[model samples]
Target: MEKNAIVDLVRSKAEGYFERGEFFCSESVVHTINELLGWPYSEDVVRMASGFPIGMGKSGCLCGAVSGGSMALGMAYGRKHGEPMNEKMFPIAKELHDYIKSLYGSTCCRVLVRNYEFASPERKAHCVKITGEVAAWIASKLLDDPEISQKINPNFK
Candidate 1:
C-alpha cells in the first residue's frame, strides 16, 4: 500500500471517535488502520490502548493518543519497549515520537493545548479536532511518509 493510505481510511473514524470522547480515540485509530489494511479489527489494539490508558491518562498526564500511537507502532513491529533496542525499530519509534512531539509541542496531556481543560462541548470539539489531527498525522507517519509531520506543526500557534 502507498504511504498515508491509512490516513484516508482512518480520518473519518478518528473524527467520529473525537465526537464521542477521548476514550475511543486510540481504538478508532487502530481499528481504522486495520480496516484500511484489511488486517482484521482486533482487540489487540484496543486492549493495548486500554492497558496504557491508565499510565497515559491518569487524570490527563501523557497524551493517550500518543500512547495509543505508540501501542499501534509497537504492534506493527514488535511488542517491547525502551526506544527500539534493535536498531531497526529504533528509527521507527524515534521517528514516530519525534514527529508527534514536533507537531503537538509536547505529548503531555496538560501541554497539548490544554486538553485537560477540555470541558465545554465547544472546547471538547476543539480537542477532538486537535486529537484527530494528531492521530491522523501519527497514522500517516507510521504508514511511511514522514513528511506529513509538517502539516500539524504546533509551533504554528
Candidate 2:
C-alpha cells in the first residue's frame, strides 16, 4: 500500500481498537503499528507497553502514546545483538518526541490528560484521538523513510 493509504489504515485501526476498548493508549499504538507493518502479533510487545498507559502506570510520566511510538520505532530501527547502536534511530525518535511535544506541549501524560478523569468518556475520547494520531504519525515517518521501511520490511515498496 502507499504511504498515505497505510497511514490512513493505521489511524483507522487504532481508532477502532480504542473505541472497542480492546487496548489502552500505549498498547493500541504499538499493536496497531506492528499489525500494519505486517509483523506478527507480539504478546511481549503488548506486555511491555502495558505499563506505559495512564502515563507510566498513572504516575504521569511520559505519555503512553509517545512511549509506545518510541517502542515501535525501536522495533523498526534498533540495533541487533552484537551490533553497535544505530545512531540514525536517535533522530527519528527525537522527531517523534518533538512531534508529540509540539501537539500536546508536553510528553507527560498528566499534563496531557489534565482535568480528565480516568476511564471517563471524556478521557477515553481524548486518549482515543491521541492513540490514532500517534500511530498515524509513526506510520508516516516509517513509510517516508525508505531506508527504515526497507530495513523493517524488505518487501515494503
Candidate 3:
C-alpha cells in the first residue's frame, strides 16, 4: 500500500480500539504498532502498556499515547538484554515526545484533557483522537525507515 494509506489505516484501527473500549490509549497504540510491524513482539506485549493509561495508572503524569508511542519506537530501535545499546532509540523516542509536547505544551494527560470532564464523551473523544494521531505518526515513522518497513506487512496494499 502507499505510505499515507497505511498510516491512515493504522490511525483508524487505533481509534477504533480506543473508541470501542477494547483498549485504552496506550494499549491501543502498542497493540496497533505491534500488529502493523507483523507482531515482532507477541500481542501479549500490549500488557506492558496497560498501566500507562490514565497517566501512569491514573496518577496523571505523561500522556498515555506518548508513552505507548515511545514503547513502539523502542520495539523498532531498542537493544535487547546484554546487547550494545541501540543508538537510534533515544533520539526517535525523544522525537515523538517532542512532537507531542509541541502540540500541547505538555505531555501530561491531566493537562491535555483538562478542559473536558473525566468521564464525559468529550474527554473520551479527545483521548481517542490523540491515540489515533500517535498511532499514525508511529506508523509513518516505521514505514519510512527501510529496515522497519521491511517488517511491516505489505498486505496493507
Best by TM-score: 3
lDDT: worst 10-residue window of model 1: 148-157
Q: Please give the lDDT score for candidate 1.
A: 0.56
What TM-score would every model get versus the actual structure? 0.66, 0.88, 0.96
List, residue by residue over 20-101, the lDDT tens digit for candidate 1.
6545555655554444444533646566566443226566666666666665555455535555554445577677667767
How many clashing residue pairs are found in candidate 2? 0
Q: Model-by-model lDDT, in order?
A: 0.56, 0.81, 0.91
The sequence of per-residue lDDT tens digits that candidate 3 reaches over residues 109-141 is 999989999999999999999899899989999
Q: For candidate 2, what is the TM-score?
A: 0.88
| lDDT at residue 32 of model 3 (Cα atoms) | 92
lDDT of 2 by residue, 1-157 (tens): 6778778888888878878988888888888877666674465677888889878888889988889989888877787799998887899899989988898788889888887987689988888888888999998888777775664443433
Query: lDDT ranking from best to worst?
Result: 3, 2, 1
lDDT of 3: 0.91
Q: Where does candidate 2 clash, by residue pair?
A: none
Report RMSD (Å) for each prediction in the order shown: 7.7, 2.6, 1.1
Better of 1 and 3 by lDDT: 3
